[model samples]
Target: MNNTPESSFERCPVCQGSGSLRHLVTIREVPYWRCERCQCTLMDARCRLSPDDEQEVYRLHDNQPEDPGYRRFLNKLAGPLLARLAPGSEGLDFGCGPGPALAMMLREAGMQVRLFDPLFYPNHGALAGQYEFVTCTEVVEHLHHPLETFSLLDRLLKPGGLLGVMTCFQTDDSRFANWHYRRDPTHVVFYREATLQWLADHFGWVLEIPAKDVAIFRKPLSQPPVPGNG
Candidate 1:
């Protein structure tokens, strides 16, 4: 495989930083690039699947709400988030897949939850209001425009609210070629811990890694006026 830079791939989709991305590797003929500025890896845009094809791939996932193993998987994000959320706090489950097991779990925990997914739910109105907490589990990797999507997440969150994200962190570059996470064609972007930290700094949110592959960011609360400054 030729490792030369592709002309069309100029900027980092996550940070919008130009000249900072280098051709990382080609796996199964799909080109992936690494951005020095944000420390995130992304698949070449040209290689992404079309909407119909992507939806078809998603349909194959059997993430049922009644599945005990699936609930345990979602609990990784839910446990920490529920610990911080107040009683009856409103939340949004961004990119809730077809089954929406996470949303079900949150609702059962005494919270008002709304669902949003471009392919599954497609509720445009759901994105209009801010919430006390927003959860994006196993979803960021599929983002085509991550920068904009993250900005939207920031907008969706209320002051001092929490944004819980769960994704398999890309730690070892040597194994990236054969990594199962990268093998999924719909997964266009890969994030490292540094990449998540960059997002926290960019959005002015405080980040916490409560568990492996789970990051919770708290939107900073408005500071009170200093004494004698008013």
Candidate 2:
């Protein structure tokens, strides 16, 4: 008896209930699933962890403060972002986690970096206004509401400001159940390249896939496009 109420998890929380499954993909023999509704790949709802359960899991993470490899990985976006930004660019590290390595990196680059994480930093005020740049590396998948969150981010940046994101895109017709990402219950929403485009169009921003798992959207000061992009 699969009495588990799917609605209890909220209707396709990723796409605000309107989003539907687009396709599925496999990563390392593990199956992954995506919603066409939001073009988001996700672990099924049954895999979800309660709030307390997730917090306990996070406590177990040992993200080293000085990991060169991690820095190098983050550089996929940071490198290009630094190039686009001037010194003193105001930046926000949404979902900075307990160890905010991303925020530190931007601060090191002479940017004014603020952090907001529901648990660790927990400063909703950081989203109150515009920013020169905003980074959500390895964060979007954790969102229970991609539509709302992304829209908020779009509004948070000044026209011509930058929004950076990093999350593996879900592919089509492949392995899913064994995907390592799905093993983590905290990751709820999945994304696709087309999904980003949907966002670009919806928000009137420029979207770029600078590297695999790395996405950037820039808002233009000019009039919005009839066929918007992101």
Compare the candidates by lDDT and give the number of the best one. 1
lDDT of candidates 1 onward, in order:
0.90, 0.75
lDDT of 1 by residue, 103-199 (tens): 9999999999999999899999999999999999999999988988998999898999999999999999999988999989899999999999988
lDDT, model 2: 0.75
Candidate 1 regions exceeding 4 Å error are 1-3, 223-230
Clashing pairs in 1: none
TM-score to native of every candidate shown: 0.94, 0.83
Alpha carbon lDDT at 114, candidate 2: 89
lDDT of 2 by residue, 160-219 (tens): 899999887765435445557666767777677888887787777889888887888988
* Candidate 1 overall lDDT versus native: 0.90
